[model samples]
Target: MTSLSDLRRALAPQPGEAGTAGGSDRPPLVVALPEGRAASPRDLRGWETKAALAVGTSGSTGDPKVVLLSAAALVASAELTHARLGGPGTWLLALPTGHIAGVQVLVRSVVAGTEPGVMDLSTGFRASGFATAARAVLTRPGPHYTALVPTQLARLVATDGPGLAAIREFDAVLIGGAATPPSLLARARAAGVRVVTTYGMSETAGGCVYDGVPLDGVRLRLNDGRIEIAGPVLALGYQGGEPFGEWFRTGDLGRLTDGRLEVIGRADDVIISGGENVSPTEVERVLAAQPGVHEVCVVGVPDPEWGQAVAAAVVPTDPDTPPAEDDLAAAVRAAVGRCAAPKQVAYLPELPLKGPGKVDRAAVARTFG
Candidate 1:
């Protein structure tokens, strides 16, 4: 794992340096590696020379890509975030450093000139450990901030312990990396947690959209239902793909309601069942609101009659007393449509996670198979 000191040095602007655009004296790209992995500055074929950091995609949906982000982009994102969150203060590193969310925390710390308190995830995320880290961060300064995924938030909210109380003290807690269920968000806020939903990817320097609003200098548009982002916070390009033009087209589909972006599911994740397109996100949203459903993930599976069938894997609030499959299917049918109803429902102790907080749809689909 790259140390915060190393990242701060690499991201800091050199003397007499203007910006990264069209610069010959660009810093070498630093690859953010996961824990237990080693990465050194070296010449990588096809990578942009002007790039400052190379972070790997989460690979939750499919094959991962190596996203090249410039120092200018990272700084722009961090500054805009602090501006939106009132001011730059101490940050706690809860997520892994290899992912964009984790890298952004360190970048924000460097930009704010504050040392960030790190969390130990060697045995995975625990509420007790997070409470301890939160206490350590709170002792430093005012307006402390942290970022987390939906899965982590779910755990924190579910457990009524020091974790929940400690998190309520932060100025803002950013939740991203995957879709946060409406119920979960409402539950957190009702419990005094100032939860802010975020949307973006490694291609856009972690998150450029907070609480459905684009940050300063970020622009959002819908090209045939697909979300496209353009701003200084955008990455240079993927390692092997074509460089981004004025706008970087995102794979996720969304719609604008009163100038606010509301993300639908991925365009490729639409399940075509009986000649009808069923959005898994729509189904999941409806099912998530139902009683006893703690977490849920919907996916399309092969079916002889419908060509594709909707299947759901749910983690109930209580494993011993799970929700009824018929009730969950009925909720989806009422909210979405009959075609969107899950033909198969599996109750599990926990949903399978791919990267960070994202659910592994492929793994869930395999459960039905």
Candidate 2:
């Protein structure tokens, strides 16, 4: 998969290029170059008509490779999203268009014949600004939608008046990139916000599952507990020519109950300590119930005795009054089992994230290692 860092570079502007959309004050509107367009004639014109811009995954696992997504596949994904979430109207472009999720936001709006309202992504996300920008966009009087990561959703849900109110006004708000803390989602829903949890990646052109079920024309199954995907939205192949098979084998482990897919965790994330299988996602759910945790990630750290021991990294709700490490650990044991409790808990001022607000696993591992 293409490294996210290199994809970041491709989205970077040419020197001295003026910003588009709401020019000068806002970031340039990054558009996907149309298929068959190239800078020079001799630069593989035969593939130009069918080739796509490759996006690299963050090499959290190993060396990054490029993932090829056809323009047709992207539009198909957008169509699924539009159909599932009612017909699309206008979109609030608050995310970087370089990423597939953000790019889909723009494409969906365009395909629906609506010009998306742009948000400034260079500066950090703010609850107040989201309210302001969204209100400005909705002034034309049409259905509107926005996509956010968990961190952004947390901030919005915390705001009493403007932010929460603004979110409630949207047609729908998609939460993805990482798991949304249940408390955050509950609070937002209580405030009358329409929130939908999305699951998918660049290979699927963006989110193909809303809540738990696969979108229109999408197929999902578990191969020995590992998630396997096959559908119209599947990408053609990778940039370096790693071709896709009939089904895409995802590294994630999942289960299907009553036809709904539940992501358990990454297969690589499972730790066998003392001959007991421990899932970090399970630990995270317990930690999320604690009083002071704003965000958390649980991972296995190298252990001399157990081979790998459960460890947790947390961001507290209050900077001054963080939860006691022991108390949080006890809470996890109470919620789950004693064996599931985190062996070590570390406090973080903030979790390192990529794209919008997804936790950067590689960055988190770097800290403890």
List candidate 2 segments past 4 Å from native: 1-49
lDDT of 1 by residue, 149-175 (tens): 999998898978999999999999999
- Per-candidate Cα lDDT values, in order, are 0.87, 0.72
TM-score of 1: 0.96
**By summed lDDT, which 10 consecutive residues of candidate 2 come out lowest?**
19-28
Tens digits of per-residue lDDT for model 2 on 179-297? 77777788788989999999887777788889999998999998899998999888766554556887999888988999898898889888776678888888888788789888899
RMSD of each: 1.9, 7.8
lDDT of 2 at 194: 94
**For residue 20, what is the lDDT in candidate 2?**
12
Q: Candidate 1 at residue 204, lDDT?
A: 98
Each model's total of backbone clashes: 0, 6
